[model samples]
Target: MSKAKKSIEVEITEKKAGNGKTVSEVYIGKQFLGNVREDDNKFLMTTAKNESFKVNSFDEGIQELIKEFHLHH
Candidate 1:
C-alpha cells in the first residue's frame, strides 16, 4: 500500500495599516502563520518537500501562491 502525501497550503494577504504601513499576513489552513513587514519586500514560504516560493508583491503574490497551491495539490 502506498501512503498519501500531506498537503502544504497557505494564504497570504496584504494589509494596510492606519499608519500607512503595509503588512503581509500568512495563513495555513485557517491558522495564522505570521505577519511580515512590508518593508521586507520579500516573503518565503516553504513546504516539507523543500519546495518554496518567493513573493514580491504581497497582494499579487498571495493570489499567485494560492493558485500555485491549488495546482500543486
Candidate 2:
C-alpha cells in the first residue's frame, strides 16, 4: 500500500480594498483562504472559514494565522 499525500500551496497578495485600505489576501491554489489588514496600527486577520483574530503586531498576527491553520515553516 502507498501513503496518500496531503498538501496545500498558499499565496498572498497585497492590495487596496474598496475603502482604499490595505489588505493582504491569502489563497490556496485558486481558492480564497483569508485576508489580513491593519487597523489602528494593529494587525487583524479574517478568514472565509469563520476564523477571526487580532494582535498588536503584524508579525504576531501572521504567526497566529499560521498556527491556526496548522501550516508548517
Candidate 3:
C-alpha cells in the first residue's frame, strides 16, 4: 500500500479600500482562510488555522501551511 499525498490551493486577492489602500484576502478552496494588511511597509497576517505560530515572513506562513496539510493527510 502507498500513502496518499495531500495538496492545498491558496488563492490571494488584492483590493483597494475606500481609503485608497490595498488589502489582501487569502482563501483555501471554498473556505475563507484569512487576510493580510499592510501599512507603511509593515505586514500583518491573520490566518484561521487549527494552531497558530509566529512566522517571520509571508512565505514562511505558506510553507508552514503546506507542511500542515501533509501531516494531516
Candidate 4:
C-alpha cells in the first residue's frame, strides 16, 4: 500500500470576533479547524469539534490542531 500525503495550511490573520477582539484562524487544508487567541500571555485554542486547549505558545496551538485532526507533517 502507498502512503498518502497530507497538507496542513495555516492562515494567520486578524479576525475580529463578536467581542471585537482579534483572533487568528487555523485551517487544515480547506477546512476550518479552529481559532487561536491570546489570553493572559497564553494561547487559547478552540477547535471546531468544540474542544478547547490552553497552550503556551502559538506554535503549540498549531501542534494541538494537528493532533486533534490526526494529521502529520
The estimated TM-scores of all candidates read 0.45, 0.64, 0.58, 0.73
Residue 58 displacement in candidate 3 (angstroms): 4.0
Instruction: Select the stronger candidate by lDDT from 1 and 3.
Output: 3
lDDT against the true structure, per candidate, is 0.60, 0.75, 0.63, 0.80
Ranking by lDDT: 4, 2, 3, 1
List candidate 4 segments past 4 Å from native.
Answer: 1-7, 71-73
lDDT of 4 by residue, 1-73 (tens): 9889866566655688788777888875677778888887889999987788899998898778768777533
Q: After superposition on all CA atoms, what RMSD does each candidate show versus the true structure?
A: 7.6, 4.5, 3.9, 3.2
Model 2: pairs clashing at backbone N, Cα or C within 3 Å: none
Clashing residue pairs in candidate 1 are: none
lDDT of 1: 0.60
What is the full ranking by TM-score, best candidate first? 4, 2, 3, 1
Query: Model 3, which residues run further than 4 Å from truth?
Result: 48-57, 60-73
* Model 3 TM-score, all chains together: 0.58
Candidate 3 lDDT over 1-73, as tens digits, reads 9989766678878888778977666777876565555656555556556345555666665566555555665
lDDT of 3 at 50: 34
- Tell me the tens digit of each residue's lDDT in model 1 across 1-73: 9989988767667789687977676677885544544445566544334455666765555565465546665
Quick one: how many clashes does candidate 2 have? 0
